[model samples]
Target: MSVVLDISRLEPRQVLFAPSPLSELAEMLHVLSAPDHHPGLRAWATATATGLSSGLADRLAEADFLWHATRADILLPARPAATLAEELDALDERDDETFVASALEISCMAQYHRGVPQPLISAKDAQEARERAAIRGPRQAAFADRLLTDPRGVRAWLRRLFQDCEREFFADAWHDARTRLYADARHKTELLRRKGLAPALTAISPALQLDDQQQRLVIDKLVDGAGTTSDLGLTCIPTAFGRPHLVTMITPGWRPVIQYPITTPDLPRPMTVNLLQARLEALAHPVRMRMCRALARGSHTTGELAAAHGLTAPEASRHIARLKKAGLITTQRRGRYVGYQLDLNTVARLGSDFLDSLLR
Candidate 1:
């Protein structure tokens, strides 16, 4: 579904724009996990994949569940940390109970809708821990048992994974990206100061909408949830690695975060052609054309699009993916159904954009 932030109680001063190394690291790991989904990171992913140690590779696989729960507050600093090392130190300093609880939340979130079990933070005994762990699955159940028995060991293992990932690739990557990321943050901060929250959020992503009447910042996400801006405030981090989609951390315990794509001024002329081709190709298919026309009228779920076009589910999905990859459509998830809407603005600009690309 969507995450609705009750912004009525929030002040303009409560919304902050900052760059976070930890948030960037999370996105980097995600890109590494599935590079195919992130074309921009393909080269880096390929280069980095070659040198990963066997131990780190195994640890990454084992801890893959934690990345799914990136929304967990433990993985992120309350405010922007100066460096990845600084964030790592903060994470390492967390108490055993808090560390285990955060890990559990991350692992549970691997399967959508499987949120953290109740009273887990206060679970004092083994039976309670096992019961809470049972709700997650065999992997998490075992993890919970390990956490209860040896939290320090679990924390050490996770820390080592983070350290190894940094030492291997992200340390250098962050060094290169940090300046651009901070510049973007400063630009967003100034924009926020001048234009206020709604415009700033809109500038961040089309997936974000300020529902003024409802006093909510509505974020279009696959997962359905709600959170409020904490006394700690809301932080928006501009990321180089996190692109195409906005990542929100609205889980209850955390200071709400919106990790948005960095806006760059330069697009090489060659990239313009590539982007134009992708969009043109996405629109070229007859079924996709029909689907876009239908979507222009109103939003339609994949099943609805398939049924209307008399296509199989896989075929419909393939078409939808093409349009989505081209940035021609936006998705809004409501319960189990995700509805897609065509971006008429991008569609309208296609003609001029193509000409501009060719001429320039």
Candidate 2:
């Protein structure tokens, strides 16, 4: 006997809450589109003005890279000849506000560096140096003392300090730089007006395509309000595995939003109290919770998860299958192994709602 499945007959509520491998796909998209800045820096800055981390500095560097690359095609003049590494080295050589400013630029560049070793110093060391320097002020003597004790710490501390300075003294300067860049792009377009670039600027098309199934998945996410316009703005391109992916920022509203090729969008909409409760209920199972935590770390095959959890391979598969059905996890086959990863963006939203409810 043959069993026939009718997907179209499924109700919206059923599909929305059902577990499916597609859930993970949605989660990956969310991470890609979220802001590029390190959320940790924002959290730390709000909590303490003095604590510092080299990791945070590195993140700032990567963000700078993104800002630059996103606008690369425009043929704007090069940012002053100084490279991030060169600027850092110069800062290490000097002991003045000029050095601090240079360090800040390096930090911004570090924010965007893909594979470089992050924040040259440990957080504890950076924090201590920040404290000492804050109390002693920006005198060369104090700066020297901090540097001698913890060069990495001193640099990280200075980077954070300079970020505040930039916000104060150079905010307008950065704004003007951006405006000039745009104006230059427009000027170029006007000069080349008869050429196709003007019409190309009108309505941006999807840089990629989605298969019918992927398109339907995206439509469902958008309709359920699980993902916002910003999240779904980019067209999904085909990956090496033939799965759809997106990695470029697409304009949605006034902001340019980055979309991750293999991730889901974390919805910003508030979850209803009932929905929050239901999500928590879904997560309450010990087996499910373990599965969620594991997926958060990265993808794993059923056998690998079973081995890690000390369950029989079939039992582990059953549990994962359940989670997939619940829309809590997703699996992809790679040769002999089917890898599983969490639907992080959805989990994050649900987790945020749970936390908010508790606070309320």
Candidate 3:
């Protein structure tokens, strides 16, 4: 489905690229809940100690398994509060009825085939969704039954669940990642001021395209909602983690919210390799080759790689460092653990350049 965002009349100031820790928390929970869907995150969760247990993990597990029904819009309200403290305060003060209704709406909406949030805003549309209910999980079906009626109870349970997760699973990581996101936002803001909207936005994600003629910023598979920035401006936030990104178009109306992944480095890097044999030698070891294949599939920790290879953590790390120095693999901080992914481009260039030189 396509998300048509009407940015036709938006001023430079109308579009703000900010950071939201609360938003990132929801995405992080989703990643934890659905490991198969988020392969890279799965590796991180497997390698790290999340400290989530009992209620919080179980609830997130339930919600994640029922993601289609537990729509991110319902869990995230996508509040555009300036700070995490402000956002937390707002969420804490949110009344029972509104909170309950949103939860129920999301629970009911999860039964449908659509992934967008716009259709669930109306009573008629929600009723239509209920009529066409298509759910796969028994736990979710049972929970939805209770959620449809006793929303207040379910809402309370959710508040407790989130508090547990925030304290146990997310608090520390949230602080560091939030700081990075804030810096990312500030950098984008400076770029927007210097280079204007289109250039700055494209820099955020090459997938973002501003069509002035249609007054739309098109992002392929970003969301399933068509939104307009007629009144309130658009807020684009740099997320440390959302892969493929997420968009919030809670109409009637809030400022359109875009949460895209900060996947690439902000600045260009000089080619750092001193010798090509270093790369070839790094791959010569069978242990390193296994790690490379594992990293190529997704991301891996030195610990996980060690366990797989029957090596100690220090031994595995030594090998990993050699590969990193060779520019064959690179590390990324994922939650509490560091993950490694292969530098396929460098690997290809090494092979191609070597063959070209020999032929010459």
Candidate 4:
């Protein structure tokens, strides 16, 4: 399925392009929590922030808590808050209720990123959201309560987060990565200036197809949200943290973001115990091993695998998701059926890496 955006009404200038520090910082948090999705990247980030203080590392790893506090909407700047500090400041300035409401929209992720955009909600909606969120767990509601009670705490947290990320690698890394990011921005602008919006988008990703009759840019993006108004246009951001996969996000009252992977694939593979441990730990399961064996037979659907293993579809799906995240399974789609196949090359590499890591 493709999300089709009507760019005919949107001016080329209205379609802004810039690097977002919030996007990068959020990505840093993502890789830490879900390293499987971002192969080789966590290794690079770990190396980049080698000199980080142990206390800071522990605090930074609390990305989920950070997400709960700032709300996903807080991170996507209304203007271009090019730095993390600026984004946090923008969030702190917003009414407490609106901020909490926007965050509740992103408290959970939908399938394949193909979920639809949540409509802008109100302060009363925020209160309702806090109550609903508390059903999942009280911590999120309590977190919002603290933020609402004392906004200064938000400012202080942002200062510390910005300091840690900047001192770690965001500054130098963004500087080093900016050349390619800027070049991409320039190229997309030129396409818009000459060939127009459709060409610029198609050039950005091969999966993009223009349907002039439909008045929308058809994209094979795995995102839930769809469409943005001409006033906000669409923000195109090239990000390092979201490497190897395109990401699309739409939060309440903010411009929609299409954060495509950076062109450069230069994630450094420094020898580290955690990298090896992550791979090894991924296989520490009987069900996953059984699923691996089932997959070895051939590319199969979750239902097919589940039936063969006498597993509930959800149970099989969970195992499959974990194995895939660990870089052991690759996916292929044929018509409506998506098949999962084992990645022998990665499994082989895992063995080699495990041996190599132990020696170090």
Q: Tens digit of lDDT per residue, candidate 3, span 225-257? A: 567788787778776756644545444355667
* Weakest 10 consecutive residues of candidate 4 by summed lDDT: 110-119
Model 1 misplacement above 4 A:
68-72, 109-141, 265-360
Residues 113-159 of candidate 2: C-alpha lDDT, one tens digit per residue = 23211123344334433454345344533444444456567567655
Kindly indicate the candidate among 3 and 4 with the higher lDDT.
3
Q: Any idea what lDDT model 2 has?
A: 0.38
- The sequence of per-residue lDDT tens digits that candidate 1 reaches over residues 1-360 is 677887777777887788888878777877777786688789998888778887787777666556543445565556778887788788888777667666665544333243444423444344655765578577667767777778888888777878888898888999999999888778777888998877776777666778858488887766677888857578888889877557776666567878888766663211233567789898888888888878877889999999999999999999999999998899999999999998876776676554333233
Give per-candidate clash totals.
Answer: 0, 34, 1, 12
For candidate 3, the 10 contiguous residues with the lowest summed lDDT are: 266-275
Candidate 1 clashing pairs?
none
TM-score of 4: 0.62
- Candidate 3 displacement at residue 300 in angstroms: 36
TM-score of each: 0.67, 0.25, 0.62, 0.62
Better of 1 and 2 by TM-score: 1
Candidate 3 segments whose C-alpha is farther than 4 A from its true place: 47-50, 65-71, 75-79, 82-85, 92-107, 110-134, 212-214, 222-225, 248-252, 266-360
| lDDT (10s digit) by residue, model 4, range 1-360 | 446565567777778777777766666666665676667676865675576778777666543554422236555554656566677677667764465445545663222243332323334444654565566566656655555555457547756876777777678776776677777777788888888766777666655667856367666644334565456788887766676556655543457677776564454232233444556676778776666666655799988998988999999888888787667789999899889987765665566563333233
**Rank by lDDT, descending?**
1, 3, 4, 2
Model 2, 109: alpha-carbon shift in Å?
A: 61
lDDT of each: 0.74, 0.38, 0.64, 0.63
